[model samples]
Target: MRNRHAKDITCTILLAALAVSAATAATAQDGMGDDDGLAATDLDLSGTDLSAIDLSGTDLGGATRLKPIVVEARKFEEPIREVPFSVDALPAEEIEAARIRNTADLVGRVPNFNFADTGLSFANTLNIRGIGSSSALISPSVNYYVDGVPLPARVFDQRFMDVRSIEVLKGPQGTLFGLNSQAGAVVVATQDAVPEFGGEIGVEVGSHGERKLDASVGGAISDRVSARLSGTLYGFDGDIRNIVFDGAGNVVRDDKSVREQYSGAISAKVAAELSDGTDAVLSLRHSRSRERPTTGVWLDDPHFPRNAFAPVPETTTETTGGSLEITHDLGFATLTSLTGISHYELDLEADLLDGFIGGAQTGLPPFAFGAAGANVRRIDETSSQVSQELRLNGEIGDRGQWVAGVSGLYSDLESTTDITSLAMANGAYTGRLKKTNLAAFGEVTVPVGERLRIIGGARYTYERQQFGGTYAGRPGGAPGLAAFAESQESTFGFVTGRAGLSFDLGPELTVYGTIARGEKPGGYLFFNQFASIGIPLTEFKSSGTWSYEAGLKGSPLADWLEMSTAVFLNDTSDEQLFTFNPVAGRFDVQNADTRSYGWELTMTARPTESWHFGAAASLLHAEITSGNALIKGNDVPYAPGFTTSLFAEYRHPLEIARRAGSAFGRAEYQHVGSRQIDPANSRRLDAYNLVNLRAGWESDSFDVYGFVENVFDEGYTTSAYRAGNAAGGGGVFAGIPGSGRALGLGARVRF
Candidate 1:
């Protein structure tokens, strides 16, 4: 059945691709023949011939063309085409059109990006170019930032509100972003307070009982002060079902993976003119979010593949953060200071039914199973961090530009877990981890000639970690075994750097190449408590990557068309690998060597005044070059060999009660290739395709829209894990299924 579904999705994707290609061809043909219609209508139509105007005195260069996209991923403002790296910038209009609310929505939209769902929001993992961590104890390879403020991975599940842009920087960013960005970085810039009074309110309703309400308001409070406030409320009834029941056969549970969420944020800014040819601006922002998490289901269960037999699961998470940014402009340089703090907490309870199945087969009685022949696990965690940064930027006689900065971070984390079952009396574990980090970094770019430039950067980082934890367990009401308390401290220091060159062949074309180094510090695993029983925990070492890349970007056909392509190779030593140790019933991290290489191409075009199209494709190859025998030469888990996305939107003027309005329609399709789920390559998920369609009508103040996602209702799995690794005891397979077909309607009002 799964094979059939996969084949059907493949066929649908091919058909959609062909249709979009045909539409683009038709649009281009029409544009070629209708030159008069394409001409500016405001020009004189009073028998004015083309040769009659004097064009010699007019400067019709790039000044009238579309402006280039500016990005901050490099710690300074620069045009994307001149950065010498791969970067995807999704603007506010695109975010709103796609209804993107979280990082999970960025899968195929960004090349070489994927997310692994573990049923819990906080436990979700992000993979970029096959570099990521599956264990909760490890930090993510891809770093995330909001308005220049770094964020912890656990809090990445927050909602997007009043966002202005999202920039995804591919490849290692350690030279500027520090340790956690070995793979890449995601920068989210929210909307700031505007000088004019304006706001928008929106509401949406969708399938599976989904509902959402969002609003934003901003305006000048005084001559020198401005403020903005935004909020969102969203919820959805689950899609999965539970089939387990007692002898009476009454239904016990329904709607297994529901989500309820709410989030809000506010920002204020003050500006003043100062002496010494200087200006000052101060900005403050705060945000909070809460959500009820979702869970997965059994994949090979005898009753139903998408149904669960376990007791209902529950998860709750809360997060809050604030930041302050102050900038001062000097005559020849700019100085900036940033301070940020964040807090996160989570509580979770789940039924380990898969483990109970193995126990029941062993003739375990009801009393021996704890409650209704089942086992349970409960967990609680809290984390907090504070960070500060200071930087200075300046330019030198139009030939060179430089930026230097210093940063510091302090963080604390605590976690506790309890396991209960009739077969085992009780077991518990507690851990506390603290971390401190400091860094100084700088980058300089110099113009070699009129069309050539050289760029170099370096960072020296120091990190310290302290871990303390205890574990205790008891069996059959006997004295507990494998009980101990231990504390350990470690310090690490490293220097990472980057060098690159870029050349402009012409006003419309640029080519560049770069070589860079990235690093991740080593840390202790608090979950490895079985060492008391002589089963030593695996050792982990700091990991580092050397990346080489080349890219070309241009507007080959004019300002209406753009194209970019890049190829990169990464060699990693002491790469951290996370896997389950079934014998010890724990997760461990090991060190290995790996390699990853990929190429990506993106194209965008505006064929006519009302038509726009975009397409992106990526091809990747990742493997464990040297590792444990079980995984050596195997493909990296969750690293799809190929991925692609295509989108098109068209808008036309509409006459509604003679008001100036427009109607627009958009279609998007994404495809992901097959991938392995574990180091042993024991399980693989087939490739799948998704189709989304949207249409809307808008006036100056009011707008209405509707969308359909997963138009074909194709069944597919987003992530999977071995039962032994997830539920403790031996079983077949468990997985998280992707969402089914859904339709939604929405409206917005602007003032």
Candidate 2:
């Protein structure tokens, strides 16, 4: 690992920045106005010492000024600081300024968050607040929603287009979000068409064939209707190099494993005001990606990975979804209905050793392989989900608010797998899973006095799951060989809820405490190496978690300085975990008990109109309290103990062709603590630091920007595991490397 002194120094500097902001706010100019009662839009920036600078609009498509972050952290629009939850909300400006293009782009930007990129989109892993699983098959601990439509895991890491805002709410939210929200929730809101006609287009090209094009158009269809259409086409060429080896263990050729990558997504939304107090919106979206991806690096090298597979691996994924939302406002309350439907499919073709990836078995002659000594494997999967929710929310006598809702969801997933080699241990595999859920939930907040308030909520859920699978045994003269099939069904009922209290310390500050319970559904794994022997595919049980949290949130220095800090503890029961049972010679996903506690802080400030800076950090300790002896007391895999990010941007007013313009420069620094990758604490990846730099010249009509990602070219691992034994037979540790440094330039035009 690199020296740690730099990270410590940066952290100290970030802390100092916060302190300086506080000091500056205390003695701000008389007209600066540190009044907390002032709305965000009412903030007075006139007192700043920028009277000599020409500060019009910072830019055409972006800005450096801080805006009040509004989010649906509780499924409704509200200022972030006003919400009692531990959450981080990013407005459209922040999203674009930070260059967050997709879901995976949020990893280090948020505290206590990490991601493991597994080459394939659907197979990647995500951990938030130290609560998540390394196995992609397990039910998600966190929930993801777009425009109020819940998204399944297969399509959860979606591309962002026309996004208005994004919010990351920590801790259990089962009372309102229901299943798959044991850890937290990620909510995204896209832009809605306005009454005026407007559109924008952007293009970028960079090193390694990195290219992107995005466009959005919106207009008013009628006095009561508006519509928007947005689309993005972007991709990059191979970033990881692969070295091909011959049968004699000699390198024959070198080439990139992933190449010719391309992807595109489009979304359309139509909104109409049906009546005096009723409104409706219809949204539809589709996305597709195709690429020949690398087989993943076997060693720790970030630039080169050895492989013998001649054709590498190919994968294609597609998703289509639609949502319908209707709302009617009564005299004192509002009623809403949301219906969502989506379908996802995947096709993968790869060269493997024993149903998985590895080059060690290439020299072995007994196993069936291609002419070049590589087993051909193929997988095809499809899944569909539909959900409907009806909710009613209203205020109580101007002091309290309440919401109640009921929702139901149904999903079906099916997949088929086959190896070209018929004599392989498993000739073919097929599986199908169906799930049903019905839930009702409600929450109410009542003021106890001028300074105190009480909160309570609950959700009752009924869940049913059915799973069936078949495995075709090895072909040929093997006696008593036949395809095996099995089916199982189960049902469960549970209640989850939250209770909390909020107290106003003053007009500028507030304190809150909350306790919440959340749950995750149980299911069966689709693929296993022991399937031929009929090991029943190991059915994991459902899990639950309890969270206790306390936080302070407010605009300490009015809109100039915004901050939130929280400490939380969580206890989980029957937490699903995937482990290799060497004794049993098969993989097992059993329940385990675990504990996690952490502190999170996020802040943003603008001491002067030209300067905008922010920092986010988290300290965490998560470990297995009770589990298999091999993992007892061990840190959870891939969960970083500490993570932090600091960003500062400077914008100088510019004159371009007699139009409003600005010159912007930004610097971002991120540090991720070391992470454990296995159950026994035997494998730990080193911590790493990254810095990104961006500069641009923006005008009312056009903007051009340049950026350097991973400016330091840091060498790090994206994911790791005990590869050989975990996958097939060649037993050794392996890893996939993170991306290397890259530079790019982009241009955007808007009217």
Candidate 3:
């Protein structure tokens, strides 16, 4: 009887695991799924573009477990449900429907991600799972990539123009993505060239005199070849104005607004079939974008003249990138190779303070020597990367499936910056920075019993960095100036890996546990002006983290609802950090041990054929564990307390003048909790919630929609930057306000 009871319990657990797996598969397949092993009838694969194909069947219970395109979880391209981690997949359709503009707009709407500071001109900084490096000058705690290519540091925070799907990989991912991806990685997939004739054009008009237009065309040039190209144009007048004046004082409100952004891409693909039931495809992509900004917004008074702010002198960014990938399928597994190259240039000219005049404004010390000129920066950056991945899969014992793969990555980057007091003027200082990295990685998976699978993976990485810069000082070396030129180069390497187990119960349930180690390489602070002080700065130090996670994913009651929950803990040693001090008027690089643990829950349900509801929430706890004397037990900067998003969409069938598409309406609510402004945990930001509503009608030929964001126009700050008052009269930091509520209308046509 005892043995029988144990067998029954084991079987029950296995069934539960299977159910979770199914839900996970379903979720991964379509970004939505239920608990049952059935699909949804409302999901018409043929009625929509195949690119929108989320799952094979409408019965979403099995959708989340399928392997997705463009990404590999564990060792295979299988669905995210099998990866044993929380993944928020944003499909191209959803992104288009939501009209997301930049990376910061993705926060709150995506799981485990948030952005605290978003002021026009103030770089959009992002935090993932309660961990982010607040300083934009340093490499981000989370890595950002476009079409499998990393964006260089100087261009990392630049706005995104043309994009398709955006995938946020939460938690440490050093094994696959490498040292800079200790916290997580974001992947942006551009729209690929379609094989069939298709095209789309869209235009949007909204408040603040905002205007945007996007267009794309794709078709097959020959039976065996295809191509696609897309472009976007956007412009907006500044909503806030600078009421302050120059020495002339003639009510000079700086028109610091922006009026330009452009992006375009083209791709071609060739396919060939082999005798051994194999296929090969070679493709290439090229894209570029540029933008000009007057200056970020700032106000001398927050009460009456709220609209007062001005664009400084001049600011601009230009980016160009391209990639080529070749893939061959040998019946059993696929071998793929990718090569990418990119270049970027940025130029800026700005009045240091918009609220305070440059002259002797408010008794503040000037950054310039003797004369106060417009602060200007000109930067040029370039990078190249090549990666190759080979995957092999085979059936094991006729009851299990197995997969293994090896990957190699090589990257090189070089950037140079020129600083001056005015646009179109001679540069005052010049600095150069460079980094190179190489990595080799492999992973394997094997099924144990009928219901269990074990997986293991490891990666070895080598990284190097070089920094050189020159700073000139006035005669006699001013009190705050240092008379020295500096340069440094360092190299380091490390290994990281992961091991995990997955158990499958019923067809609709699954349970998984995983432990992984990830690392990030540290480098010299060449531009870190404060390093010259006696801060004991190190040339190079590697930061590493270990993550522990356990989770259950499955459908609970009916086929219409599915849910996933996970608990995770992350421990780190010598974590990289950038700290800002208001009193010292300085920014410092430091290291500390830290611990982070959190719980996440995700749910998706289709109560009715036309109605869909989804929600994801995460509660996080992060604290300093040891190693830092200045900040021993303080919370990590830029980490939000909690983040959540809830969305409901309804589609209604209509004649629509005899057209076949449907009309849909969606309402979404996103919430970000209050957080500490600095590591010391002194000032606190108020929690805020936003409501967005959209209504639209779409068919194979056309789409029309309208939306309202931040419907209530609530006042909030997305981020803060410290402007140390060494003279000690004004406030230490300035908070940039989030954008106000705006409404817009849009239209899309396809041919």
Candidate with maximal lDDT: 2
> Would you estimate the TM-scores of all the predictions?
0.88, 0.91, 0.82
Off by over 4 Å in 3: 1-71, 116-124, 157-164, 254-301, 304-313, 330-332, 357-427, 472-483, 530-540, 581-585, 627-629, 726-730
Model 2 bad stretches (over 4 Å): 1-66, 245-253, 257-260, 300-306, 353-373, 421-423, 474-480, 557-559, 725-731
lDDT of each: 0.72, 0.76, 0.60
TM-score of 1: 0.88
Across 1-751, the per-residue lDDT of candidate 3 in tens digits comes to 4533543453354345445544654455465445544444433211111112232224333332222333443334554555556566667766765666776677766656766543423245565665666556556668777666666554565445547677777777776666477778877767765577888888989887777787777777665556776666666664544343444445544443432344444444444443355544454444444444323333233341232223334545555666555556665656555556666555554444544323223454222212334344445545555555555555556334454455555555544444443322233334456666777776666778777888777888887777766544432222323434567788888998878888875555678898988887887654545322323234636778888889876654444556778898888887766675445655666677778888888766554445555677888887877644667798876666688776666677776887898889887767777777666554566777777789989888888999998776666666654444424365444566666788999998889
In the predicted model 2, the residue pairs found to clash are 724-730
Looking at model 3, residue 221 earns an lDDT score of 68
Best by TM-score: 2
- Comparison by TM-score, 2 against 3, better one: 2
What is the per-residue lDDT of model 2 for residues 217-291, given as tens digits with 9 covering 90 to 100? 999999999999999998888776655555555656666545558999999999999999999999999999988
Angstrom error of the Cα, residue 188, model 2: value is 0.9
Q: Root-mean-square deviation of each candidate, in angstroms? A: 6.2, 4.8, 9.3
Q: Would you list the clashing residue pairs of candidate 1?
A: 368-422, 369-422, 370-422
Error at 652, model 2, angstroms: 0.8
